[model samples]
Target: MFALMQSARLESLHLSVDPVTGLKAVIAIHNSQFGPALGGCRYLAYPDDESAINDAIRLAQDMSYKAVLAGLAAGGGQSVIMRAPHVESRAALFEAFGRCVEQLDGRYITAIDSGTSTADMDCIAQYTQHVTSTTAAGDPSPHAAMGVFAGIRSTASWRLGSDNLEGLRVAIQGLGKVGFALAEQLHAAGAELLVSDTDAGKVRLAMEQLGAHPIAPEALLSTPCDILAPCGLGGVLNWHSVAQLRCSAVAGCANNQLTNLQVGDQLERRGILYAPDYVINSGGLIFMALTHQGAQPEAINQQLLRISERLTGIYAHAQAEKRSPARVSDELAKKMLYGE
Candidate 1:
């Protein structure tokens, strides 16, 4: 655990275990230089404690980058609740997890992430004031999708010589709330859509509702398209997958899409303009952080547009320096977080 913290440059790691509720949670705080650390709570089944710890650490790091780039007064942190086979009461488990967050005294603020929902955050809110994404805060998926949509326009302008997504073939993987919402915006913009999801129901709905062409999950990456949006899990673009990509660019709402930093170099070598995940998918973070801080609705929307502005700058810097945008983004985020 100490080694992991040291390697990741984490500020601290807090653990909570409730024997009765079977709540084994890890909250990794990556940095608090900007303000109180804020990130989403992920409740998913992990193969082991190590995987859970790694996920918390990696996501917390990215949250730091996301918050800094979005100019939010928050640092980076993440909480992961390892899901067991069954729990007698879901609310009870989350309430216990909320209490665990309360114990931190506001050092880490939790919201909804993968495998968690607004209802789950409502349960967490019942026990602590350090939680967001309640019913009142609203779902952040659409806001995140909107940010990605704007970033895609900027990407198209840089890579395809046009900011118009109209008639562009966009291949989207995953059909979760963010993915489907992004598809909706893309379809409305007159972009041809090729969508894939593990849930056949979501794929069918996209086909019927959005006129999206359904592709097999295994075939989405290699299928030729203008842009590939990965709205699913991270590590989806590794060495092998990058080698098989047939798109001009990659921009999505997934966190940590690259398996490692080296994959950024691979994308650069392949002439694929890779928008750094944290830079492009920061809208959800912007909404969750600002909403929790009581920012007005218009302020949040204005902040969302900064996603495109930041990406545009990053892309320009990458082109001028002959470097990957991912690397440039990391450097900028590090300078903000560490004064490096």
Candidate 2:
């Protein structure tokens, strides 16, 4: 009951076009204790309207907590689009989507997310002025990659008791912009990599760039490795998928990775380390605030480092109380912002 009430503070938007393509659109808006609601617009080909709506609700809620945890001024929000290929390229729907954002009048600022690109945001920017970028001058992806990499290192240190990533076999699902960028960082840190994606081109590029071994999408799930990173969509780590996993730690940039809220306890029972998704993937949001305010990296780095500290504390609290990391994360975030 305590957990359920904390989850209801998020607001959501739902849009869909039926019979034509069965595509749906959803947006979530999480307001700030500090300022207005802000985040990126994500476009994806979801299975249905309900899925999009669920994604929007969960993402917006995650953003709200993420902002609080990361010590940012803005709150949480995300937009989702379910589309049929060629009918709506990101170029078309994203800008039209920006029209939706314009109506919000800075109440919610949209940037980039999964299935959305800077190129997509560039188009969206034409429609609305309340937009943030990872690349206005210094793109946030690389910096975000750096922060997540730092987080991974921190996780390794906590879990493995060693800072060295050498010879660590990490399996990454969905090598998109952020994942690919992260792969390079891990490579530099001496981690052996296994990567998978639906796009053959991205797989090939990852193999060439990071020297990662490629696994097909189906095969990617059960790959025997140290870390299981999901950088794609949400709700991948459920009762079903958790039964299929063959890794030690779960980490990556996917939001709402848990299908049910209790799955983190299930992972812990299975002897798997679960790095809460909102905590690890928060670099994007932190970077958004940093760039939006035109601050230097030095100052922003301090904020992102706080994410690591927050994770460390959550892990400790979860470990001590035998609680799920996600729940612990929520409590800690609420504690920081609202004095809970």
Candidate 3:
């Protein structure tokens, strides 16, 4: 565990367990040069404690990069609550997790992430004032979707020599809150949508409302399209998948899209324009960070608009250096976070 933290540059890790509620949690804090580490609390079933701890550490590191590139004065942290069959009472479990967060004082702030919702954040807020994305704070998914839409436009302009989405095919792999919202925006922009999700209900809703053609989840990645938007889980772009990609560009709101830095190199070699995941999918973090600082709505929107500019800058640097954008992004973020 100490070796993992060292490799990831994690500053601290907090573990807590509540036998009564079957609550087991790991909170990993990475970097604090800017300010308190801010990230989401993920609740999901993990095969083992090591997997949970590793996920928290990896996500916390990504959050640090996301926060730095988004120009926020915050670090990165992530907490994961291991879902077990023994866990009963969701509310009680989250409440216990909240107390765990409070124990960190102001070192870390929690929000909603995968397998967690605004209501879960509300439960966390009960124990610590250091939480966001509560029901009262409003959902950040739509704002994140909007940023991704803008990013796609930027990517189209850079790669396709035009910003027009009309008549272009986009394959989206995920139909959750953010993904569905992004599909609506893309549909309105006249982009042809090919969507897939684990939930048949979500796929049906997109097909009915947005006229999206449904693709099987397993086949979405290799489907021919102008772009591939992975709104699902991370590590979606690995060796096997990258070799089969048929798109000109890959951009989405998913964090840690590439399995490792080497996969980014593969994308570059394949002549695919890869938008760094953290740089492009930072709208939610921007919203949560600014909201926590009491910034107005307009201020938040302005920062969101900067997402495209940041991506374009990264693309340009990558092009000039003949390096993958993901590599350039990591270098730039490291410079900001550690002055390395």
How high is the CA lDDT of each candidate model?
0.94, 0.77, 0.93
Candidate 2 per-residue lDDT over residues 14-127, each given as its tens digit: 354433433356666755567777776666776766666666777787888888888787887877777666663546666677676787777778777766677777877889
Give the Cα error of residue 58 in candidate 3, in Å. 0.6
User: What digit string (tens of lDDT, one per residue) describes model 1 on residues 148-188?
Assistant: 99999999999999988899999999999999999999999
Q: Which stretches of candidate 2 lie over 4 Å from their true place?
A: 1-7, 12-25, 88-92, 134-138, 336-340
Model 3 lDDT per residue over 1-340, tens place = 8999999999999999999998999999998889999999988899999999989999999999999899899999999999987667999999999999999989999998889999999988999999999998978899889899999999999999999999999999998888999999999999999999999999999999999999998899899999999999888999999988999999998888999999999999999999888888899999999999999999999999999999999999999999999999999999988889
Give the distance in Å from residue 307's predicted Cα in candidate 2 to where it truly belongs. 2.6
Report the poorest 10 consecutive residues by lDDT, candidate 1: 132-141
User: Which parts of model 3 have CA positions greater than 4 angstroms off?
Assistant: none
> For model 1, what is the error of residue 239's alpha carbon versus the real structure, in angstroms, after optimal superposition?
0.6
The model with the greater TM-score, 2 or 3, is 3
State the lDDT at 121 in candidate 2: 75
- RMSD to truth, every model: 0.7, 3.5, 0.8
